[model samples]
Target chain A: MAGITIESITKSFAGVTAVDNVSLTIEDGEFMVLLGPSGCGKTTLLRLIAGFDLPDSGRIAIGDRDVTDSPPGRRDIAMVFQSYALFPHLRVSDNIAFGLRMHHVGKDEVTSRVREAAELMGIEALLNRYPTQLSGGQRQRVAVARALVMRPSVILMDEPLSNLDALLRLQMRAELKHLLQDIKTTTVYVTHDQVEALSMGDRTAVMRDGAVLQCASPMEVYDRPGDIFVATFIGNPPMNIVRAVARDSVVKVEGVEVALPEASNLPAGTEVSIGIRAENIEVHTEALDGALPATVAVIEPLGSHLLLTLAVGAESIKASVRTDFAVKRGDPLWLELRQGSVRLLGSANQSGPSD
Target chain B: MSAAIRRPRRRATPQRQLAYAAAGLITAFMLFPLYLIAVAALQPRTAVFDYPRALYPSPFSIESMAFFLNATGILPALGRSLVIGVMTVVLALALGCPAGYAVARYRFAGRDLVQLLIVSVRAFPILILAIPLAVTFINWNLYDSVLSVALVHTVMALPLTILLAASVFLRVPSELEEAAMSMGTSRFGAVWRIVLPLSRQGLGAAALFAFVLSWNEVFAAAVLTVRNPTLPAQIVGALGQSPLPFRFAGGLALTLPALVFIFFMRPYLFSAFGQARS
Candidate 1:
């Protein structure tokens, strides 16, 4: 129902900083995901927004109210925990109605709203069952319904689908995305799974060490990572990072000239790290113009594509080629890093990745 | 993998046979005394003194039982013990659950030391505790009353009850409480609606323990109450130098209530059905 604005938030526990000075804005109806590895402060930031933990120094505003100092009950925000923390003693109907009752809604209204939520989650048959009687996926739906039935100003999810099996996680990812979009409530989702972030988030905030590395659309984060960490962390087999140097309008990579769109922006003689996505590298069986010669070190045939580990001089890189590309280990090949697909990551020599 | 499917393959192995034997021996060791008491309590007055006692009562007579039941003070004292037991359960749960919850959920300074002290209250000998309490009760004008005996029993049962309650509370995940709070309930509401209901079985066990302790405590009841002693304290006077039938009858009377208490409390002491419940 309302967007949340967080400003300069910094939280620490027992002298260790969990959420450093960070600022973010979640627009109304925006599905913002905070994505990062463990100990990266994504969960901590979500807790701060949920009013479970107060930041040491910051302002958190839900809609127009400053809830930085308020308790979780007064914040009017709902959360779905990773463990699907449903009240085990309560049947599904009561669990869904719990928040409504807490807010002191009418009994009739609570029943109708719980019923509506159960239908929305396709769990109407499970309304009379205890949480222990439900499967993992069923419990997940109940937890989500429990949150959505409240219809609070904002909703927060902390790795909500992590406990489900892989296939179920995939199925729930789409279901949750559609559910959140249909509700049109501002949401903040936290997870370490890059696939979840890329698939579900309207805007993904890549974070590390208690700071946001990049906040962009999923495709933007994938194609144009803001820094070396974002580039390497967001990919599956991970993006290839090759040390390069900028001279004029050209960047030299492993003693070979590689053109980059932003090569002119870098200072001369500055060492830069070029990030290339595995699927971005063009592989050719025969030597062609402006291509670097390489030997295939490893080949992983993944049905639809061939994941080739190419050895270029002393450096190795991964390339996802078409399944028809016939190549074996130790086979000579040529690779072309296109200007559009090649990302100029942080300066590799002195300063940490230019943020 | 169903346990029923996996269980059949491992049955009657050497280790399982040895385990069953050991368990049977222990069960007999515990039940043999009760069996002897039952056999003697049923014997007629003349048959009680036979040199070779009957392992099981033959032509069982209810003479000892009738005489024991007809004893004037027995019923009143039994009623008094029931009151004390019930009172002890209620009082212990009310006073101990919060302290147990605090110990389980909070991280205050000296938390470990406080738990140790709470548990160490039992290390003081019961006789040592009973004498001082008797003096205190007299000074407070609470001596020779069911309330006085129940209060003494509460003190004796507190440490274990608190310990049991804490372990029970610890098992109910704090995540459930946080989830409730996030849904708009305050901390107090969450504990009342979620934590208490989820931990009822554990709390029930704690209550049962306090009840059994109060029911069986003879020393404190003897030292504190004269006119209103509990069942155990009332019968101890007739135990020594009493007729054989009377001794066996008193033993059965003393043990029967505890057996009934355990019978009612069995479900709470173990898991409810197959899964856990409040």
Candidate 2:
């Protein structure tokens, strides 16, 4: 119901900056996922928006009202904690109704709302049981139900599915996506899982070292990551970057030349790196034109596909090929880079291309 | 064929037998005094003072209990002890719960120093505080009052109660309270609704401990009051002069409440001792 605007937010703890000068805007009814590894300040940014931790210098606005100095209770927002954080002593119905009761809603309304939320979560049978009696997935539902009953403008979730086992996490993840889409509430979700971010988020904000590296649609982030870190962090087995020198439309990698996109406009003799996703390289058994010859170092079977680690000169790159393809370690294999799959970066240390 | 292939039941090994013997000896050593108290309380007045001591209850009579209840002022003293014990527990918990919650949840300037001060109070003997407290009570016209004795007992029990309650509060995750706050309840309401309920067993344990401390304290009650004596004060006052039957009956009276209390508090006590299944 409300969009959140964070302007120049900076927070520090014990003189170490946890969230640097960062700004982001979450549009109304958008599912914005803050994704990164641990210690990347994603959680800190969520906490700041939730009014749990005040930023050192910044302004936070929900809708049109500035909530930068308000307490969490005054923010008209609800949060589903990573731990589920259900009251152990309260039954599931009472847990879901807690927010309404706190706001002094009428008795009949509280009961009806509790019932409605329970039904929404498909947990009507669990209404009388305490949190300790519920499994991890059930507890997660109760947590979401509790947040939903609040009917807040925004819901903040911090890795709510992380505690569930693999199958349960997957099921809950799909269910959560459907629930959020049905509610259409402005939600901020934090997670370290790339697949979760890609599948669930309307837009994913990738963060690193207390700064936002890229904030874009999931595919855009996956296909055109803003930097070396974002490129490496967003994909499984990660994007492979090889040191190269660019001259005209061609880049030479360890004496092997690979063609760039037709729009290549970099200056001649420019030092660059070429990033290729594991799925973007084709493996050929025989030497082919415009292909780089390499020796397979390792092959990891992953059910439907095989991940081949190849030694190209001094660098190692991975390629995902069909499982039926005959491949083995120490075999001579030629790899051809697919067009439009390569991203050119100027320097390994630089965040993005100079252009 | 399956039965023939089945494993035999193992017998207790030598080490296990020796462990059982050692445990039995220690149990008997601990129970011997309690047995002697029971025997002495049940014996006739004449048999109580016999040289070898009456090892068994013979010619059992309630005469000692009857005489102690009627001849001495023990009945009123028993009532006074119960009142003081209840008052001490109420006061300790009323003051200790919030202090404990504050210490457990908040980080403030001098928090460590405050904790240290509370813990340091336990290093000194209660007698050291009782004499000074008695002098202060006399000056303030609180002398010879049950309230004065209860106040002293509260001091004796408060430090341990605070430390124990703090640990209990620590076990209830702070995230639950934060989640409640985000759901629109204020911090105080969150604590009242969530934290207190989770810590109920711990607080019960603390209250029971305070009650026991007040019920069994003799020195402070003896020093602080003359007219409204607690059971322990009365027992200590008549210790040497009273006959063996009266003394034994007094000891039983002083101990019976604590034993009954522990029996009733077994469930909460298990959780207080960190034995609850999460």
My TM-score estimates for the predictions, one after another, are: 0.94, 0.93
- Per-residue lDDT of A39-103 in model 1, one digit per residue for the tens? 99999999999888889998999999999999998888889999999998899999999989988
Interface RMSD of each: 3.9, 7.9
Q: DockQ for each of the predicted structures, in order?
A: 0.50, 0.43
Q: Please report how far candidate 1 places residue A270 from its true position, in Å.
A: 2.1
Q: List the residue pairs that clash in candidate 1.
A: none
CA lDDT of each prediction against the hidden true structure: 0.87, 0.88
Docking class of 2: acceptable
Candidate 2 pairs with clashing backbones: none
Candidate 1 overall Cα lDDT vs. reference?
Answer: 0.87
Instruction: Identify the leading candidate in terms of DockQ.
Output: 1
Residues B17-70 of candidate 2: C-alpha lDDT, one tens digit per residue: 999999999999977887788788877888887888777888788788788888
lDDT of 1 by residue, B9-64 (tens): 65588998999999999999999999889888888877888879899888699999
The Cα RMSD in angstroms, rounded to one decimal, for candidate 1 relative to the true structure is: 3.1
**Considering every candidate listed, which one attains the maximal TM-score?**
1
> What TM-score is obtained for chain B in each of the predicted models?
0.91, 0.88
lDDT of 1 at A165: 95
